[model samples]
Structures are given as structure tokens and as C-alpha cells.
Target chain A: MRDHLAFRLAYRGTAFKGFQFQKNVVTIQAKVEEAFARYFKESRRVHFGSRTDAGVHAYDHFVYFPKAFELYTALGVSKRKSFLSSLNFMLGNDIRIWEFGRLSSNFNVMEDIVSKSYSYFILSSPVEDPILTEYFHWIRHSLNLRAMRKAQRQILGTHNFACFAKSSGVSVRNSERGTTRRIYKASIVSRLHPQMKIGQILEFKFEGSGFLRHMVRNMVGTLVQVGEGKGTNIKSILRSGSRLEAGPNLPANSLFLTGTKIRAGLYAPLRPQTE
Target chain B: MRDHLAFRLAYRGTAFKGFQFQKNVVTIQAKVEEAFARYFKESRRVHFGSRTDAGVHAYDHFVYFPKAFELYTALGVSKRKSFLSSLNFMLGNDIRIWEFGRLSSNFNVMEDIVSKSYSYFILSSPVEDPILTEYFHWIRHSLNLRAMRKAQRQILGTHNFACFAKSSGVSVRNSERGTTRRIYKASIVSRLHPQMKIGQILEFKFEGSGFLRHMVRNMVGTLVQVGEGKGTNIKSILRSGSRLEAGPNLPANSLFLTGTKIRAGLYAPLRPQTE
Candidate 1:
């Protein structure tokens, strides 16, 4: 009987290429595999819940792999706390293992997803703040929040998001699943920055059953244009199903994967067992 | 007759070596002077209210220099707003000139100082946070907040801070001004971090008539030892006037020059004139 382990982690994506495995570039997956190889002295493949883009941060995310129980015994990791600490020590400061536990061998990290929440931060000001440069996208002018919110309302419920996705040369007609996705919630809010007095930070939050590649970013870009009084017709853009009708994709640095829910109740146990 | 200009600026000190000008290395003063030279085509020396160390951020600080009013006209910077925007473009994103105005030539930025406020941030957690790595010092264990506050009370009022000063081989007897200084306020507060849920960010704030070299960092280091139940006698350390008796100087990255009050009322005018 093979035992599996699941991990919920957070990472600052400034130093990583992305969460995917690639050749010759530093990535989150590569680092995790490297740490596992160094600690367990065995090669193992890990599956991620989502493949986040380059420079996209994550406050809550998931990964799972087969656990070598004998290796844990040999390494004296009797508790989940020891296992997390030892793996984190090898993973460096950029990524943190927030929680980990034993899972059934048949548990699938990717297929069990129920919902995903993402947050995009925007600093609306004439000048960029040095301290927040890595985490916020700076705009030179103030945005029309009312208009953006009005546009956000159109994103709720199921819609064919082919227009918002990056074209992969595969026609939507030929794709089995197509580009339809259910957006559970979409909203925007502006708040005073704690450090910068002159600017407001706008948070664009979205929760959905699933999203197409570049969907959230493209939607935000379109809403930003609406906020700028560009007179963008988001409804028509969705109806047209043309990528050209959507606004440009925003930068990934300001985007964050805030939360994810799984059918297996992976995040239900907030506190790891000490024993 | 020479017109003087005064600027209130904020900076994130990650890329700067220090505020003072030095040869062959990057410093805040060096960057400012370079920007001035590039824009005005002249070399001008700037006087800073406080000379902050490398990796120390400042939200409110002062600098003054003789204004090249003629150069502003020559460069088509007719308004103060234009002057600021143009200069900031040259200074890059690390430093921002928040306010600038005409100052009396006799106004001395350094000697007219009434008070200076500094804030130091510490994150007490088992592991370091990657996002806050540039701005906070991470401690592995929980600190005794009550004990730290108790130690903070001893720092108020006039005291000889010679022990906290970095020794320059010049004895106190040979110095023109002794290390005696007046501290108006010393406080420690712990608050939940906005992003990181696992750790509490402790803020140590100090306000004084003046501070000696390495004074704030040294004081914080000693307070940390006391919080760790080291039973550090701050009174004895001050009385001995020995650097070795105090705690180790904390890292500069976590320290910030929050504000400065000038006897000349440099900060009295909150808004800069558009004309």
C-alpha cells in the first residue's frame, strides 16, 4: 500500500520563473523537487493543483506526491511538524510549507478542486511606490471604480471565456471542453495604502469553478479600460468570442492566488497534528 | 543672492549603500547629486537632516541645497510640479520627492532639528517570510512583549548613550559633544501582520532630540535580549559606557526614519505650491 502526502504552501513569486517544470530556468516545481531529492534521496513526481504564471504569487496553493514512509522513519521525522520544517529548510525563504498531511493513495490534487480565488492589486497613482513595486501594478492616473465595478458584474456566472484566453493555435471548436467557465464571484474594492498616503490600492477579486489561461488578467485589463472611460463593451466582447475584442493582459506580478477549495476537504485541518 | 530649495523625500533603502556620498559605491546622496547634475548640468552639494546608514528606509527625511532657479527656467520647468516630476524621473523609483519648496538660505537642515522619529520592524516566527525579507528582521522564537515594554521605559529622558555608539577610537573626553542625548518617546507595539497570519510584527518606535551612531539598532538589540529573558541590565550598560555591554546591533534593513521635526518648521507646510 502506497501512502501519499499533500502540502498547502505560500510563495512570493518574484524570484521564480513560474510553478511549472521547465528546462534551465528556476521554477517553483523544480525547487520543490530539488529539495525533495536532497532530503529523501529519491526522485519523485509532484502534481500541483494549478500552474500559476511567472511572477504570480500565491497565498494558498496545493501540491501532492507519493510519500516514502520508510524514508521518513529513517530521517526521524516522527511528526508532520518535523517533516514540514525539514522540507522548508531545504526549500529556502521564498516558499513556505504551511501544512502537510498523509493522504489516501488515490487522492488527486488537481481533480478534487471545487473553487479558486485570485486577487489582483493595482496602485492607482502618478508614481510607483518603491516598497510596493514588486507586488502592485502602478497606473499613472486614478481609475473609475464605479465603472470598473459595473463591468465586474458582467463576469459573474457561466460564460464562454474564449475571448479572454491566450490563443494556443488550437481552435475552440476542436477543443473538447471549450472555454466555458463558471465565475462564482467578481468584485473590486479600493483602500488606502498603509505606507503610501498619496495613492489608493485597488483589489480585484474573483472566485470561480475554473478559469481559462490568461482569463483573469485579460478580464482585469478590460475592466481597467472601462475604468479609464474607454467605452469598452464587455458584454459584446464576451459575445464576440474574439481575443482581439478583449483588453491586453495585465502583468502577472500583481496577481495572487489567494485560496482554493477542494472536494476532499484538504484545507479543513488548519492546524497540523503535533503527534 | 542665492535661492535655496528644501525637499522632503521618502526612500526604500534596499539598493542604497547609505545616505552619505562615497567614492566608487552607490549611495542616496550620490544618486541625488547625479540626478541634479544631469538635470541642471551643475554640481551642487546637498545637506541632509540625518545621515542614515545603508539598508535603512526613510518615509520622511529632509535635504536642502542652493536652488538653480535659472536652470529650472532653462529646462522649461516653470512650475514646482514640473520640477519635481522631472527630477523624480531622473532619481528613478527608489527615491521620491514628496514635497519641495523655496527655503531661506539661512535655514540649516541639520542644526535646526528638534526631533527625529525612527521605526524598526521585527517578525517573530519560526521561519522568515520571503515577501517581507527586505523590510523586517525575523526572530525564530516568540518574544516577551511585556518585558520589552518594561525595558522601553528606561530609554526615555536624558541619558548617556555612549555604550550604544559605534566606537571611532575617539574617546568621549576628546569629543566636542558628549554622547548625552534626550529621548522623548520609546515604545514597542505588536500587531497582526496584514499578509502573514502566522507571525506578529513588532514595531519599536523611538523619538529623540538626537541619536548617536548605531544608537537605535543597539537599543533594539538590547531590548530583544531582554525580551528573550536574558535579563540584560540596560541601566548598567549605559553606566559602563561600553559597547560590548549592549546587545548586538540589529540589521539595518528593518529600521526606518519615520519623521523628523525641524526647529525651522521645515515640515509646517504640508502642501507644495502648484505655482
Candidate 2:
């Protein structure tokens, strides 16, 4: 039990390429791993539930690190917490580490994730808000919520979502290899922010076994089209996987990776994710 | 009212200095006047609060242009909103025309202002939000709310805050003239953003007749120090308006030109200043 570790992390996506590693571009995975490497004084390998694309965000994300790993064995609570605390101090501002806890050796972030969900907020208002201009998708015209819901229903049960994934431009073989069974839990709910900007915020909560690359964002774009009275049969688009093209992806600033469903007997506490 | 003309403005403070358009460097006043001159196709005049510093921001802050002035009469609303909008729009995101409304010739954003108010929000948590980073100050330790409030009382009455205003290198003589202020209300409120990376935000609201240059920021800095257990005698601090050569200055990003106080009979609504 003492040979494993789990970290609950949350980050603003604006400054990161995504939760994975990449050169030149700043990615969340790179930063967090670097911190872990420094703290344990040796490299500790890590894993996450989803591979969020560049500009994606996480609310209560999790990371798993192995204890058999040589890096972190001798560390005490103050040293561990201090490592995180100092990273925040040194990194200065762009990212923050919330809290960490030791996990059982066999825990896996991806396999244990029960459901992975996302919420996309669109600020469809004519006026530019003095405050909220950064974190939302700003649309000028009103969107049709009912129509959008109708189109959203087309993506419910497990289907090969090869049509929804981004083609890496590698034309060779099986496009279907990337996907696993996924269930669309519920229709999106659209509401206005109560305090300041009077605009529409569309939220989609999906609890699924897993996800495909760009699948959620593409689905949202197609749904937004229906909401804007732009189209009708998105199911047919999915069936043939024909067009191989998606409409304008709403900006990543508004999309939030809210929660991840994890295995219960595994016992991961509800805490902010590591940096 | 039929002859009313709207204008878009841009300025490089590094050249003329701040928005006030001084002779020392490029003042915002001169740059704005230049834009209005080109828009009117001549050197027509306009009026604003004459505040805001170098590198400050404004989305659709307003200024009154005389209705009888025939300078921009040739330009239509679509052309005006579009052309001027494009000028800033083409320049980049840093510049935007938040909105425009036509008003009577008597409109004065300064004299007509009934409530002149500003806000400073600090990310008073150990975690720094990457997304909301540019919008708030991140303080590592918990603040002394009691001390902040005690200091706030000193901000209530009309006083010459000369010590608070930073000398603009330009050092305009009499710049501190008649700078006594009556703070209508001053208080701190904590806003909890559920999805925000940071746990809680502390905001300071300051409403006064008007402010000296960098007055609010300098005052906010002193208060933050008091809250952090670094300072004493907030009143004595305010009385020494000759500028603290080493006084702590709070971050400006968290500071906002939230609102203005104007005379009751202006075209746009403004809060009335009170003792």
C-alpha cells in the first residue's frame, strides 16, 4: 500500500499545450513530471486518465506514480508538500499543485477512470464583458437549445466514432483501432451566468468508459451547428464517417475537463490535482 | 443629436506617455485627438475623464463628442463601427471597441460621473490559476481580514492622497492640485469561483470623487501589506502623499477601472458621489 502514490490536479489550459508532453509548446504533463522528478530526486513515471489536446483543461484530474520507483521512497510529508509548495513558488504563476497522497501499487489513472466528462461554455452575447472575455466562447447571435439537444441525442450508445477522431493525415490502416465503447450520459444544459455577463453557457456531461481524439469537441461543434439552426442529421454524418471534416471547433478556452469517473474499491480521495 | 459622431481611438503611451496626452511622451490625449482628427478628417475636439496610465486598457470606455461638430458626419454608423473597430481590430486583440452609444453634446464622462469606482482582486490562495493569472494577484499566505478592514476605514473620508500617487517621471507641476477625495464606500469581498483554479478571490472596492495617478494601486499595496502583517498606521501612510519611493505597489492586472461617478443628468448612468 505504501509503494504507490496518487495526485489530484487541476490546471488552467490557457498556458499549457495539453496534459501531455511536447517540445517547444508548454504542456501540463511536462511541467508536472518535471516537478515529480525534482522532488523525488529521481525520475518517477506518471500516467493520466485522458490525453487532452492542446488548449484543453482539467478540473479534478488525477495522476498515478509508482512507489517501487526509486525517486520518492525516502521523502517525508513536509519534503513532499514542500516540493509541491516550492514548485508553485518557483514556477511562480502559470500552474499550481493542489495536494498529493500515497496510493496502492496497482492503481492506474486511465483504467480506473469510471467516467470522463466535459462542459463547454459559449458566451453568446453581443456585448464584450469587462471581465469574462477570456474563459468562454463568445457568440453574437442566439442559439436554439432545443434543436441542439435533438442532435446531441444522436451520439448516445457505443458506436465506432472513427468519423469523429482527427485524421493524423496518416492514410494507412485501421481508423477504428483508437476507439472504445462510450456512452453519452445526458443532453447538454444551457444557462446564463448569474452574476455578471448575460450570455449563454452550454455544458455537456458525458460518463463513458473512454474517449476518442477530438471526439467530444467535434460532437460539440456539430451540436452547436444544430443549435444555430445550421443542420439536421448528425447521425448520418457519424454512420458513413464521410465528410472527414468538422466545422469550426469552439475555442478550447471555454471547454472544461470537469471530472473523471474512477474505480470505487480503488479508493482515490477527492482532492485538487497535482501540478 | 442627428449630427452626433462616434470615434475609435488608439495611443502609444511610450511616446506621449499616458492617455492624458502630455508633451513629455506621447500622451493618450494626443493620440486620441489624432485619431479623432483623422476620423473627422480634421482636428475636431473631444473630452474624457483624462485618467488611465501608460499601457492601461479600455474596451469601450466612452468620451463625449459634440453633436454640432460636423467632423465625422460623412461616416455612417456601419462604416464608423466597422472602420474604427477595424482600426483597433486590425491592430490586434489588445485594442477593442467594447461598444458605442450616441449622447447629447453635454455628455461628459468625467464631470457627469456620479460614481467613480475601481476594484482590485487578489488570488488569495496558495494555488495560482494559470487561466485567471492575468486577472488577479496570487498571494501565498492567508491575509488578516481584520487588519485590512481596519486600514479600509482610513480610506473613507476626503483627504489629500499625495503620498499615494507615483510621480510619472513627467512630473507635471500641480498634478496633485485639488486632489482631496471622499471615498463613498470601501470594502473587501471574497468571490468563490467553483471552476476557478484558485480557491478564493479577495476583491477590494474603492469608490471616490476621483483618484490621483496610481492612487488606488498604491493604496491597495499599502492595505495588502497591512493585511499581511507588514505595516501599521494606515492613516499615517495616506497622509504622506509625497509618494512612497519604496511603497509596495499591488499588481495592476487585478485592478480595474470598474466604473465612474457622474452628475445625475448625463446620457449614461453613473453612480452619484457622496461624502
Largest DockQ belongs to which candidate? 1
**For all the predictions, what are the DockQ values?**
0.30, 0.18
lDDT (Cα, tens digit) per residue for candidate 1, span A141-256: 78889999999999899988989988632256754457887899999979865554566799999999877778888999999999999999999999998899999899999998
In model 1 chain A, the worst 10-residue window by lDDT is A266-275
Per-residue alpha-carbon lDDT of model 2 for B95-175, expressed as tens digits? 333333445566555455566677777877766666666667877667788898888888798887766776622244554
* Candidate 1 segments whose C-alpha is farther than 4 A from its true place: A1-3, A67-81, A104-106, A168-177, A264-275, B1-3, B67-81, B168-177, B263-275
Minimal lDDT window, size 10, model 2 chain A: A168-177
Q: What would the DockQ be for model 2?
A: 0.18
How does candidate 2 score on lDDT?
0.62
Tens digit of lDDT per residue, candidate 1, span B149-246?
98889988999898898763235674445788889999988986555466678999999987787899999999999989998988898888888899
In order, what lDDT does every prediction score? Answer: 0.79, 0.62
Q: Give residue A167's lDDT in candidate 1 (0 to 100).
A: 69
Candidate 2 residue-wise lDDT, A1-275, digit = tens = 45456666677787777878878777877887777666556666577767777777777666767663223446676665565576556444566656555566666654667777777766665433434656667666677888887777778887766666666322335333355457758577777643222456667666566667676777777777787787657777767664364444557777777766567766544344322
Q: Pairing residues by index, what is the TM-score of model 2?
A: 0.79
